[model samples]
Target: MARVQHAKDVAAERLLSIPGVHTVGIGYKRRGGEVTADLAVIVFVDTKLPRADVPPDRMVPLEIRFFMDSSDREESVPTDVVEQARPVEYTHIPAGTLAGRARPVAGGRSIARAASGGGTLGGWVWDGLNDEVVLLTNNHVLGGAAGTDVFQPWGSTAATDHIADVVRTGTLDATIAAPVNAADVLEEIEGVGPAVFEITTATVGMPVEKSGAKTDHTTGWVEYVGLTGHYGSTNDFQVAPDPGMPNGRFAYYGDSGSLIVERTNPSGGSWKRVVGLLWGGNPELGNAKAHQVQDVFADLNLDTLCAGAFEEFLDNLFAPNFPEEPLKVTPIQLPEPVTMPLTTGPRVSLSGALLALQQAAGRPFARSRPLHRGMARDVEARLRLSRMGSDLVTAIHENRVGLARLVLDRQTRRALASAAAPFVEGVWTADELLGRQVTEEDLARFHRVARIAEDHRPELQPLLERVNRILGELPGRSFDDVLR
Candidate 1:
């Protein structure tokens, strides 16, 4: 992986200088419209051309060979030429009223400098050295030196709309702003819930999602990591929109400073781990570029402030109201079972199990059927269970004894166990049930129970481990040949 990255670094500037090349990075090679396992230096161009029509010097090379000082040998790396238009910074003037202002401003909302156009307010972070929570966004969006005023929802002039003042600026087009009232800022995004305190490095083919000012919430896959672009940042990464999406778009104008996060499914809900900061992209072609979030943190000396396990537990416990009175209701009646004639049929196979597991893990919020009646009640139940499950996992992972003790209280445990009974039992019998394919909702339910058991119930650890092993064997989870 280091060799490939080094080779890309060596070749990026020269490639960018070429007339047709727009960006340079490392990615999987494509052959006859199919992605291959081979690693290649990817060159983005406006259009693919036949060798006959282009000048020899302007054409992209098929392979890049460079001498390695560490190995004392010349290495040859293949190249992949992809057709993609040049990406531009995502900042623009507001044409109409934008709807993204709140008392406590969060990430993924429109914000701009007093004199500049609008851009997204990435998220909130803690400046430990300064002992204050501040807003994280692009330097271009919150331009000028320290003390520049920023407003939310585009061209607002009200004094109340003036939210933050630029505090620090750094490389990767990142900047931090001190909120006028620290209490008026939140550590969450608009559509996505609380941001996870942890941050991770981007890997090729990793599934990612982001909420931006222009596009709202969208999911995508990392096309390349350690990408070198015209922006002069060596840690930039490229993302392409999910093929299943309707418009095939990810970020757009006014979407700068949006936070790109990993799409992960834990017990409580879909938690987002900060991965990168969206700065610019070619929205029409669905090619977006972002800086590695770790770089942003290191450069700015900032840390994320997210909700802890005990806080989440308390919020889940008291936020909702249960029915005040027990109403008389008819019990469900079961029909008499009848033996059926046996016929030749396909038995459950490993492939089927893997498919079910992938669907469950990949799309955490997918539902099998739409609910008409009692929808709100059902949603509340799921959310409560999810929160409790997440709290247990977080406590275990962080080794928070106090939080764990609170989460494992007798009353809380009983409520959680009762709510998770159906899902926990289904995990055991899921393989036994034949004929029908497992639905994402069913697997999501089982996943929640498995997470809770993995953290609290030792007896179920073996089952959970076996399930994880199967998940590890699933294909298409990663696509970086360099990592192999």
Candidate 2:
């Protein structure tokens, strides 16, 4: 027998003294402590259970503790209600375990061969990660062609391959569908899954529907958008339709990859714009949250709508090279939030970030300092190039090291920080510079910057309105979006 340590023993070591529980047995559920000299705490049980040790209470239960400290892995989620904005906590939360959606139509309608008992309802075309765009339909919906092998849910072993990877030119849509020839034969494999395809989200309320091999056609409202979630048992990724329109209608199972939309159902009105792809949902709340079919498309990279600079920057981050500095603008003028690849001379450890703030408050070397290799090529040169920028360089450089403690002297830092607009310390944030925060004057400066910002094109209107709203929401001239 091994010398089993109880949870109590682990806690004692971390505290450097005894913990809440004075004593514990071999197996008991309780707060954890460090064990095996690692950061993780060891789980324990109250009994060894040579046989099934029955509890006096007649109930055998297991204990699992969710670490509360990790906000990223929160056990609690947003409250399901109307009008409340979804809190930006977990960036990528997926909706549910969904396959896609399919419908049956005339034999001539489907991508499947007409002779294979054909009928086709509209399906969705979604992103499949690379150049591939997955076509979702019922296994029965799409008939076999003479050639090309299909992968079943698990593997091809005679279980009838339902999901077929799209190998045609470009993506097949309502206007165009993947064609099937006589040589195609869908092989079946044992122990697989429902035939599936991911549906990429279209516009804000693009209408869509599905006809599964089993259940023909079903409709629902577009809910939730831009979601990121994990598969049930695996870490496979999903980014669901992140936002949705009014009302709470959405997709359900057997409707996996169901084209989410404000579908132009013979019904009328702008409210009918289709959105969302059916992937999964919350069983606990019934139909409260519907996952996006686009998640699958995005996961698979199926949809090929906008793959210009806007698209490439997302997946293949380093695909494009930046020859110049990213644009700088006031928060009001900023287009969308961009994650520019920032390089500091050295790694920004916690202590280092704190140290730089103090140094900024004090004095820094007058000229450039060779901090580390990761510093931008022009960083030191820029410091040498401008006088105030040198000090701003040091302060900004410290902020690069996680410097967040100081009550920002917007005026003082602005004087030193900006290479373009170097002025005196009387002003700080837009609020300060405009003689107050986010005034009409601040909005004017925002427009000046927006006029020059290439990214701000097509974004000026909404951005301007949002800035006003945020300023109106501000309490006593406090600025929090800056912190964000």
Candidate 3:
């Protein structure tokens, strides 16, 4: 009886048992996780419950109480998390460690209320300077907070953080906080403050913790701190802090502004420092990113509790809040996760890096007579990749970061594999996809990448510096090492 069943099949039978029940309901669905034999029960019900309380689009949380020969069991139903929280702005935000704890207007969302731990959503803050603190969040999510004040978007643009204001205007004390306007919205919104960050002297791999409304408080370790991307850009990381903790379930909605506190054990004693303010993860990955709070406070030197006077002042610079229409900044679908384990081998697995490198190579070994149609499609698959490799060499020699970024995009990465196939073709069987080769022309193209590792290619550097022990073995190898 645990197997899921058609609501219609059991609906009539259930209604027949209830004399006063005049209507029967039916539905079909596979429960979360799996369809186990123990749970394969058909859902049919005869209810006098108020169905009108919720709209057709709304889902009701039903607590099913059922028992077998031994004992009855109960399961709490779930509602779409989005419907519970509406969009909000910094104006409605408050300062605290707990996420989603703020009193969102009748219908809105708060970071204090996001999921907890690594999987939680919402913006957060960190005490930045001598007195003031800074707020953080994404630009796309700003529109939602400004418009509806509801946390409706779960998969996409749902959570946000804004600069907190302490002042009050009318009874509508939007003093808790207000939203910042990055050039995206200037004319329409009222006091608009763009999200900003302050820098700190915190080192990488520090242990940190933050509070959220949903889960209260959680802690994690830093994977990277003050990191610069391809173009010398700074970024923050908060991955699985410790080995014991499970993924997600750490923080929930409305946890934004939670502090990332790390402790340092000095020779004299141990102390804690404020590092950053929560910023939404990158759009493609949705991984959490934060603004260096230390720098933010120092930049503005604004007061935090001055009834939000600083926030009020900053807001005034932005366009008033006359949302002509709903802002276009909405969360889109998330990208697929990278689940493969880290593996290393000799030949640069250009295909893995390119994502579709094999497709690009299109090198096809000759086969016996065609046994089926569409055999023409089996021509040469590896060649396609070889051509791709040649193209990459040319593009790299030309020095085009834009082209490289394009090739790296998840969808079209195959083109890069197609370009990189040749350079890696005759590579040593024991070689792994360490990184792209450096060239002589590349010296003028991107010198930074070239400097990190000594030139293994003879043509690029005639003489290898043997002063450093790390460079000892480099010069002994053939110059062609860079090319292969």
Candidate 4:
């Protein structure tokens, strides 16, 4: 038994590495119309299962069979090996144009057909990994890509229906749709009911129930855990074969994406928790399987959203200005608040604007002081750029287009300081005038705000363009040159 179980585990890992093999598991190999205790690794490739009319001994496909020995080595079983191969299967919700919900939509009901507009909505599930509500269904159901519009009650009834946006898409044969309105979602399933609050794992022989678009409600037993299918592998459950149904199958074609939940208590009304996302099954053989929900979420990286939020919370917890170590036990004492004076806008008069421009340039006006004979040439250039900026602002306000253009060009060149700008220590540009730490950030911020203002106020567009042009050029000079 231990060898068989290890063989099962090793075979599953090997098949998973091979492309096109969907799921893997360990089950009794059927021989001469009977299941043998001799365990074999069951693998589902993109092949079809044998129909009921085919005898069990003849049901095994000749193309594939793999086995593991006690030494944990994999060898292809001989073609004469009669072990039955369960072909690839998928949820079978049928294609239809039906509409009009008899009530608010719930899981296991018909939603939109596949993005191909064909399959059924498997179910609705809460995304536990992320703190948001999502309508759970198959990737095939939601158009197999992000941005598919999911319609409630089928896309057939276009008027007076609900819509949700597909947000996540993946190879697990699963997609999650987030609705526009939160209230439209229903927590309770449609039939064979379980109100899903949390997801649980699957165990072999676990009694599970599923409500789907086609079957409505049905009960099944977990036959194999960790089985792979064409798109990906997880677990496979066998729907109880019922003689009354077509081919004795429990679910029909439209049941893809159905939620499989564990029945907590067999004899009483106990809560059923979600165990898997049903995608496909064999009608003739009564074999079916689903991707485990937790596995699906993890594969899709859905939990990363929660991790980002947790990081932000941690940042706030350790913020500075708190009491020092030994005194840390005491409540934090915030520093006294600083008050800043508010100004409406730049000074309106030409003289006042010129003074404002000088202050903004962070340098003395040319006429304010006598320059030393050996002073760097860029100092005089800086003063010239500030004067030109003040002149351009006036020209723009007065609609002197030609003068504004010429002054704007000169000012922009000066801001770049390619020739007239000096490098300041540890600064990209003008480090001596503006501290190294805040130079880049403050200039970038100013550029962004001016660009936005140009978009909203056409009258100020010319002035704003010049402002942004200068800010963009501010990073060209280095700190050493400015100090020299």
Candidate 5:
């Protein structure tokens, strides 16, 4: 359910900026009396029906359905206007206190210390197997090994004040510290409510709170989940910084291990549920990435150690809103999450860009292998007449513009231009089959390919430009109009 909601959130973030889109939600698409899970983007206007021109179509794998909020409906405002209260942003409490209720240690306050140094104590957790309580923080904060001396207020607190011992290390940059006195720690957190035994998975757009050594208590929104950042794969998620808060970054350098929890309504109680363990993030992007608690617990092998307790908790966490009926068709599976890999090469490839565009436009007609071979052959045959076929192929393969331009003289240009007509026609051959679903992905690919061509064959620029304008028309635009 969280996964589905997260997908909807990604779609909403991309679509909300469009002129007409009012709201987005998780819903079902029915075909032949069977329901398929999908994200529905809703737009309502008393005048002309508006279409949401969502960008980066590949962001969410779910099939998006544009819904017009009929003019006849009684309600004027959007249905999803209900907002969750934001968590308190700052704390005046001093550091050195135990996590939770002990002396109100704000999120940014430093608590636990290790051999390398001290780090902010994020939150607390229960050792279901040993029947003991432990302070939850980042593995990097606790020396990433057992028996590290944990200090309160760090070594800077009037000479080292040892408070606990590092017990275990877990995936997702998490560690458990067995406090000398289990009862000394309180369940209550500064600003936020108590940390409940209940755990919740991250949902996109969900309000959440966290405390760290550098920024104290802060609140933010869940921007994404199942995100693969520079941090190696797995179930990691991201939190967008709260613009209203003073904290500059969601998670700072010393803030690793901060525990993020769901925001509770009405201001106070034990309603807050564990959500994520903050490891690191890019502040420039105004987001912090954390490992989802479900994945963290699973990596810790808690299900095997705690047996029934773990399974019961998971059951409650993942229970459906209503009993789900089987669907006629298999639901669309989201692509495996990946942040662009760090490498020194062309960020976008011609064939790669074309492939992404085809999928986005619902026109996965034929494999790019056939198209690549055909295009390469056409270019080859034309350049061979100029006795520069190998040079052109090497230039294209190496992405070298000067070499390509030198080889593509007027005569070769004329031949390539003529050959390009057949290749371009193939792209639209399945337009009827795909319903001409143009998207930003296609526009971007066209622009990128055109820009590369501009660096080589200037004559081909106008041709690709025309192709882009033609495709852009299907989603609501004209040849001369700006993309909507």
Candidate 6:
């Protein structure tokens, strides 16, 4: 392999200078329309002309020579010429209908710099050092000085459509953009579902798939790895379209930055493991070129393809809403029976009255405490608060008091209802004992409840205070801290 690579390197520049030649790489040679096991310097050309029709100087050589320094010798390696009209970078003009605007943006959708043409979003990746999620795409799509605005659906001019900003670019034709809101991005590919966070190296003959802005989803097979194309781009792999694909093309223009993934089946389930980032291709020959995914990650210093914080957010979102069993309230036991005199004259036990009240309230009271606790920890609930708080904060921070008040009105009713359920239950229980004067045993039971409540106070207080402020019942400075 090294000998063949060295030979290709020696002959590539001279061969590429030939009139019809397009690219030079190493791959299995083909004879009589069938690929053979023999390795050769594969030359892609615009036309496969007969010797009589081509000039001697423009003719591709059958073999090339490379010097071996160790043995003080030179050796001849064979070459194979295949027809490819032209190689093209997959960007600029929109050619297909697979792209559209999406919210909570994901990969394989249309995206572009605010001032540039559109391309495919490769995927989402985590920049652990910055504690954020960023969008991955081709350099030509998102590359620029830091803070260059990016948008979805290619040419959207609305401020609300502005999604990310270019933060990093790589020599591998890769670029990453930090999203304006990390929570608005998902580590998923359109039509292909969630991608495996890890990447695998591309190998010859490996079957692969990619979802792109223009092509949507397509299958291909690795033709060659470690291939160098025009302009001296290294560490690239070539993909040949599946024979069943339309026009034998795996990718089209505007499909740049599409993530090439290998689909693997283990235990009867399929997973998409990333292999490369699509950049350029020869659509006529169905040969697409991409930088190895491993190289892309190394160049960008990325941790993983999926955001950890978003994973946590998802976990909180899909968790069960209610515990399997109802919350059992243990009655507050007193050391001795405390009799309370009723206005009717017959004496009743305070603990007995409390038990009777709880029974009267039935499942509604029994279910309330757990429901409140569950909602406090749920992501959907948190998102509600975050959304409301963000609206109010943005309004106030931007000096829009009228908007803030309107947001306050809408959020306050919901917040008060959510915040008051557990408190209402507590007050109702306390009201039952109010008719009888407070006693030593009653005071002891109250202290026990206080001690129990204190353990969970730290966790519950932030949520309560955030709700209180939204309802205009508590004075506070920032809703952001409480939401966090």
Write candidate 1's Cα lDDT for 265-380 as tens digits.
44343346789988888868766789999998888877655322333333333322222234589977669765789889776644346536533433211112211223223333
TM-score for candidate 2 = 0.25
Clashing residue pairs in candidate 5 are 107-211, 107-212, 107-216, 108-212, 108-213, 108-216
Query: Residue 76 of model 2: what lDDT?
Result: 20
Cα-based TM-score, every candidate: 0.62, 0.25, 0.26, 0.49, 0.42, 0.59
Residue lDDT tens for model 3, 261-324:
4433232111234465553332222123344555444433432222122222222222122222
TM-score of model 5 (CA atoms):
0.42
Point to the candidate with the largest TM-score.
Answer: 1
Compare the candidates by lDDT and give the number of the best one. Answer: 1
Over 4 Å off, model 4: 1-5, 12-24, 29-40, 43-102, 113-115, 128-130, 157-159, 234-247, 266-269, 301-484
Candidate 5 per-residue lDDT over residues 330-435, each given as its tens digit: 7767798757767687656565576565445332221232211223333344444433334433333332222233222334333433433322332422222123
Report the lDDT of model 5 for residue 271: 41
Which of 2 and 5 is ahead in TM-score? 5
Global lDDT for candidate 1? 0.66
Off by over 4 Å in 6: 67-69, 72-75, 92-97, 128-131, 265-270, 306-484
Candidate 3 lDDT at 198 equals: 17
The better candidate by lDDT, 3 or 6, is: 6
Ranking by TM-score: 1, 6, 4, 5, 3, 2
RMSD of each: 22.9, 22.8, 24.1, 25.2, 28.9, 22.4
Q: What global local distance difference test value does model 6 have?
A: 0.65
* Angstrom error at residue 52, model 1: 3.0
lDDT of 6 by residue, 1-484 (tens): 7788788888878988998786788888899989888888888788888768888878888899778657768798899888876667888576566677788777888898777877999887755434345778898777757768888878786788878877777666888887765445766777776653657788778898888888888898988776666335656889999988876778888889999988673222233678999998876676689988888888777645332333322222222343345458999999999998756777665534654643343211111112223322243333445566455433322322121122123233234333323223332222221223333444344334333323333333333344445434212322234343
Which 10 consecutive residues of model 1 have the lowest summed lDDT?
363-372
